[model samples]
Every structure is written in structure tokens, then in C-alpha cells.
Target: MMASAGDMDTGSVLLAEKVTALSDPAAYPEFTAAVTAVETHFSWVFLTDGFAYKLKKPLRTEDMDFTSLAGRTRNCEREVYLNRRLAPDVYLGVVDLMATEDGRLRLFGSGRVVDRLVRMRRLAEDDCLEIRLKRGLVASEDVARLARGLAGFLTSQPPLGPVSPVGLRHEINTSLLDLAVACDGCFEQAVRRVTARLLAFLEYRSDMPGRDRLVDGHGDLRPEHVFLGPPLRIIDCLEFSDALRRRDPVDELAALGMECERLGGAWIGPVLLEAYGKAAGVFPPAGLCAFYRGLRALVRARIAVRHLMEEPIRAPERWPRQAAEYLRLADRAAAELTVPSGRRPSSSAAL
Candidate 1:
């Protein structure tokens, strides 16, 4: 006989028990031996036969706090809502991890809610842009599809007003400071040069395209989050902060290009930008695009190095090497940030 919800324990079950239960194939309605668990910095993703369930770790960070059930639940709901903008069919809904009267855990069953999980349709690993790029399977048409899809999504969104260059500088400066400490000042000169160039661009480049055309965009638009399709689907947006999501679309695209280039697809960036320009009807100036790419690269470098600060770091040796690589890329992109001479302005108004 099965336990009833009315007979369940009032106290919330331990997180470990919930994790253990979900890790088992039997916990799901359709059990399979192919169930695999992946642990990210903030959540545990359990991939079953046909679905993926994400359980947020009850942790607090400087930027985000998932310490309370309400907080996690809200974040999960936000994620589903925001990601639907690009990957509508992928974000299914939020579900509960419940505890039954028989001292057993179940998903979506009648019992006391112990935890929340985001249920999503599992996508093919091979279809992800990062995997395809590594395997040399990405083509021009694929990137064009991504560009058009992304441009359509972005253009459909309402503008969230202009982003402040001062705020951006402060954010980048904080990250650079963290990177300097994390790398033992090894990249101090590079950081200084990058920071100076970025500051110069922000201060003097009022004529830069898209200064006033900010929109709520996919904040973390990396290759791993993109799935190549006849209709491309982008997932895992920065749902934690609406303020962060308010960005220039060109800035977001530049970040995507930077990540793609880092993954050995340098040609993808220009193609994406060109296609996006055609679709959006606003070609971002070369100087502005270079500035954005350099800015994103520096920030990415900081993110890569900051991984070393994690307790029991994942792949300790990989972070520094990757950080160095990002720094090199940042330097190369920053080198292209030459303030324009007296040149004729374009007919386009914004990016």
C-alpha cells in the first residue's frame, strides 16, 4: 500500500535524502539505467530517459542566494519564464520533490513538499553548438539560423532603457580586481591595459552604436547554451538578475562570438554579426563591436580565473590555463579598439 499525503512527516526531509532519491532511476515514473547526474556550481541536474530535473543547491553567494525554499522556487519559476523567450518548448515547468508517509521521496506526488525541481525536456548533447563546433560539424547556415533566431527574439523584446557605462565599468573593475588576486597578479599588466582601453571607449565613444538601444537579452549567451536547429533554441539565461539581463543586443552577441571563438570557431563571430546586422537592420560599427568583444573577453577571463577560488576546485589546473587563454584573446580584441578618426557616420541609428 502507498502512503498518503496526510500521513507524511511535517518536517522537511534532508537534502541528501532528496538527492539520493532523485538519483535513483526508480524515483522517476519511467525508470531507466541511463540516468546520469551532473553537478554544476549552483545546481544538480539529473538527466533521466527523456527528461532533466534541476535541483538548486541551498547555498548563498555574493551575487545570488538560494538559501531558502521560497528563493529557490522563485528562481526556478523565473528561469522557466525567461528561458521560454528563446526555448519555449524546452522549459517545461517547476515540480516538487515530496516526502511520503512511508519515509520515501517522490516527484509530483501527493505529499509534503521537501524541495523544488525544474523539469525540462532533455535535449540531444550532439545538437549543442559547443559540441558541434568541436566536432567540426558547424556550418555557415547553422550560424545564420542562430543569428536570425536570436535577432528575432531580441528585436521582439521591449527596450529596457539605456545601460550605464559607469555601472558597466564598476562591474568589470570588480571582476578584474578579483582576477588579479586569483591569478597572483600574473596578468596584472594585461588587466590594466584592458581596463584602460575599456574605460576610454566608455568615456569618449558617445558616438558608438547601440548606446541607447538596451534590451532584456540572454545574459549568458555562450555556445554551450545554444542548440543548432532549423529554429535555433537558446537556453540557460541569467534569470537571477533582471538588471543584468538588461543589455545591448550587440554586447550579448559579442559575448557569444567571444565564447565561440574560444572554442575554435573564430569565423562564427563575423558571420553571426553580419547576419544579425542584416536581420536587425542596424550594422554595429566595427570599433563598437571590437570594444564589446574585448570587454566580454576580459570579463570571461575573470570568470575563468575565479573558478580557482571555489572550495575543492573542479579541475584545479584547467582554470589558470583557460584564464590565460582568455586574457590573450582579450588583449588581441582590445588591440582592435582604436578610437575612430574623422570618418563619415553611418545611416543606421542604433544596434
Candidate 2:
């Protein structure tokens, strides 16, 4: 389902509209585009009244690359396909530009192909789980509902194949190596300790039974990507590569737990885990909670480091503080794994 630049229309109609939207309109004189746009930690999303168009920047990271128009188109198509699994009602379709008789860019062609766009039905921003939580609209019942919904989704899908186990490990190792390189001397020891623990855990579990129980999962299941609506809808998957989404179910839960904790809902992790486990008819391996907690922390640390690495020019004034927080989380995760009982107070118990 990967999209390519050739899929869009070469006509100037749609192209003109999109070109005008960018802050630097003059940069693209070929198309008469106009729209208000905003940048995120990852993509440059342009907003129109009725629809939203996402354009992947020419960015590269440890796990992904959107360096070419072709790559971006493919990723955008992947985004539409994968997100539809959870949010079928919201993900409309891919939008493309077509060429007109005079070499003008239009939307989908009555003519020739131009640039590709992922067109989506716009949802109210306030409906996002992150926003709802910030507005004090989220409740414990809502968390429980989300847990049940995700549990149902995970249980219904088949487990990942054996090939995925090796792939997942490689991704974890790669991310850890990147983190180790980016961390300062003060934080390197902590990062190394946690990374080592995770590596050990991966080694021990690689041969464990039930490899098929793992499946392709939402690689970045943060609150921000979840929409709190009639039904919980997860969106914006890691579409650039398969390595990001292919993981253990517990790993997915752990990521969500870490996000909940960071958002001041310390108890939600255990509550959600308990609910999901009950629904799935199994408990995660004993020490895995600890292992994935450490893994999640390290993942977040790596992400923060990647952000700093990718765009040092726009580094937030709080970049140092953010880095420090990630390091602290890594230290805490390492300590948690080494404890006699891996099940310490919930990772988010104090929020």
C-alpha cells in the first residue's frame, strides 16, 4: 500500500492550492497552493478547513528515513493503510496532484500525475486523548474502556511470526547503541546498564515459547495518537519500517504505561495491564514488566536524543531539561530491573 510520487496528478489545480499554504509560498512557484500549516515533532502537517494533508519532511533517524519524495509518498500511503486498522472511520484516503493540459498541477487527474498527498478527514483536535486528559475530561472509566478496547484488538490479531522476534531485537539493539552514543558521560553509565539488562532479557526470551503470540503492533501508542471518541481510535503508526511495530504485546502495553505515568496517571498503568491481561486470558512473563519498563524508558531516551541530534538548530530551551529527565528515567528503569522483585511500586505509581 505504499504510495509513490507518480500516483498524484500533474495538473496544477490541487498543486496550486497546496503551494500557497506553506509559509514560504514563493519557494514553490509552480503550484498555486494556499493553506495554514503547523509543524510537529515529526511531520509538517498542513490544515485545510475540510481535510488535513500530511507531508513527510526529508528527515532521517535511527529507525526511519523520509529523504526523498518517493520515500515520503510511500510512508504516507503506509500511514493511511496501517492507521485504518484502528481508525477506519477517520482515515479517508490518499490525496494526489495531477498534471493539467498546460503542465499545471491539479488534484487527482483528469490529466497526468504530479505529487502525492495523504488526505484525511479532519477530527477535532480537542477530541484527542492528550487534549482530553489536559482538559480534565478523561476519567478512570475511560482508561478502563481503552484497556478493554486495545485488549480486544490485540487478542483478535494473530501473533507475529518467528522472523519478527529477530527483527525486534535488532531494532532494540540499534536504538540502544544510538542512545549510548548520544548520552553524556554523566548519563552513559545509566544508559549502558539499562541497555545491557534489556539485551540480556532479549537473549533469555528469544527461545521462550509462544513467539507467535507477538504481532505487529502500534509502534508509538502514545496518548497523543489516540483519539478519545465513541470508540478509542489509535492513529499515526510507525509506518516507515516494520521493525518499529513488530513487538511483544507486553512491550506495547509498557509503552502506553510509560506514557500514562509521564502524564501524571501513575495508577493507570497497573489498572490497564490488569484489565488487558484479564481480557487476553494470560499474564505477561513475571520480569517482563520490568524489562519492558526499562525498554520503554530507553526508547524514550533515544527518541529525545534523536530529536536533539536531528535538529540541533531548533533545540528547545528545555532540551537540557528534557535530556536530564530521560536520563533519570533510564536510571530508574535500570534500578527497577535489578530489584529482587521486578514488580516494584507501579512505574507510574507516583505519577
Candidate 3:
């Protein structure tokens, strides 16, 4: 996806608008109750006392646009719609951040709307799955329970028919290419290993042809996005792209497995895989699981190293190490891509 000069100019203009209009805390007086504001990839999140406000950044990518109000509004609506499938209680709705005549921004008020934001109920921060992973407190029961719950969640949505083989290949290759370009410093060798495995898997699609119908699911079903129960809530689906969000259940479960293995909970990964197999009555192909898990690891590794691109001179102290760790996970998972190189296994044994 090479960018044209016009595309570059358009992206720059949109980025400038976001930085100028949405970045200032002082601009949004209606958010006076906000405890803090956090920046995500393409949105700004304001954490109020009981609610969270996520404002789109009006940014542009080759495949996505958050620049126009109509575009943002539709995406905002889609965000609520898709996320409600998993966390109905959490994604409250969408609200307009209108610009008042007096030049101040008011949220959910009558005026000319400047930007659209997805409003959500804030989950318990301390109880996020990351904290549990960090403390080594995740019980086998918890993993099993999450697996069962996730299986139900994945199966709840009606299948959208088999995902296109070509589209699936594009999805994996695009991310892998970007990763190779983004984390070349510490990632070159390991990335080559993972890329080779993914390429091999891509070639042998008949063996792991993703037979399941795609679900509109949590595209980024990571530990950090999950909350441990009393009531389990997974917030922040990839609202920006439907192609990225649509996935087979096995692929989605494998993503969680990848993250678990990354964060020192290696035992938890196999438990999740086993749970999914038992609950869903689907023995996901070994190579398919390994490919999905490795691809996800490489994706996370790319994200971690993007800070170098953003602030090469003074990126965070921890990112290089984090990137290296992710790359190692990528290599390990890729190397574990079992079954013969070009042989096609029975695509579904448990189904």
C-alpha cells in the first residue's frame, strides 16, 4: 500500500486537524469531570469518573479514514454495534462532541458537532487481566472459565460464510510486511523465521483453509483489553476495520493464546487451546493455531517498536526490550508450526 503524494498531503491535513482540535484538554470543558485522557492508536480516550469517552483522531491510513464527521459518525455507530455483541453493558452508545458558538467544546450538547465519540462504562482498572497476569494469580479455573465463555461468545454470532481465502492471505501478509519494515533493528532475524512459517501456511491453505464462518469479534482480544470477573468484560474491539475484526473462532482463541505465552503464562496458552477444543467441539489444526499465534506475536512486536518511528531520538526506555521479547515469541511460535511443510491435513477433525 504505497502512499501517493496526494495521500500523504491528505493524511497530514487530517492529522493536523486532530492535533489542533482534539488534543487540548482545555478545549473540552464538558470533560471537566474527566480524571485523565489517554491516547490510543487512532483515538483519544478520556476517562471520567464513571464513564469513558473515546474520540476519533480524524486520522488516515491507506485502508481507513477517520477524517470526516460522517465517516467518524458511521464508524462510531459501528463501534457500538459490534462491541455490543461482546460487552453490551460496557459500550453505552455514541455521543457527539459539539463545538459551541463561544468556541468551547461541549459533549452531548446542542450545537454544531465537531467530532463523534464512543461512550462506554469504565471497567475496573486494577482488575484488568494484565494485572492478574503480572501478579501470577490467573488460576486454571479462570482460564477454563474464560475459554468456555469465549467459546459461547464466538459461537453466538451466525457464521458469515467462509472467509475468502485471498482476503485471509492479504490480512496476514500485510501485517507481516509492515512488521518487517517497522522493527528491523531488533526483529530482522526472528521476523524472517516467522515470515517463512506464515508463508508456508499461506501456501497450504487447503490444510488450514479456515473452514469456519467468520464472526464479527474482538479483533484485538488481548490480555490488556480483558477484565477478570465477577463479570468479565472485554472492551475495545477494532472498530476501524471490519476486515480486521471478522475472524474464525479458532483464530480469535489463538490470539489470546499468543498473548498468554508472551506474558510468562505459557501454561495458560495450552489450557485455553484445550478448553476451546472441548467447548467448541473443534480441534483447530495445529499448524493453523501456531500460525495465528505467531502472526499475532509479530503484530504486537511491530506495535511495540513503532515508538522508534514516532520518537527515535527519545523513545520510551522499555520499548526496545519489549519489542525484542515479542520478536522472540514470534520466532518460537513460528518454529512450533507443526505438521509437514506443504502437506494438507484434514482441515477439520473435530467438526
For residues 3-48, could you state the per-residue lDDT of candidate 1 as single tens digits? 1122123264555676788888877766668678888867899999
TM agreement with the true structure for every prediction:
0.90, 0.77, 0.81
> Which ranges of candidate 2 are over 4 A from the true structure?
1-35, 59-70, 98-112, 162-176, 181-183, 200-210, 316-319, 338-351
| Residue 88's lDDT in candidate 2 | 91
Displacement of residue 27 (Cα, Å) in model 1 is 1.1
Candidate 3 per-residue lDDT, tens place, 223-281, comes to 99888776777777887787788887777888888788778888888898898789988
Per-candidate local distance difference test: 0.80, 0.64, 0.72
Supply every candidate's count of residue pairs whose N, Cα or C atoms clash at under 3 angstroms.
Answer: 0, 37, 0
The top-ranked prediction according to lDDT is 1
Of the two candidates 1 and 2, the one with more favorable TM-score, higher being better, is 1
What is the number of residue pairs that collide in model 1? 0
How many angstroms is residue 179 displaced in model 1 relative to the true structure, after the best TM-score fit?
1.9
Residue 212 CA error for candidate 3 (Å)? 3.3
For model 3, what is the alpha-carbon lDDT of residue 173?
A: 59
On the 0 to 100 scale, the lDDT of residue 166 in model 2 is 52
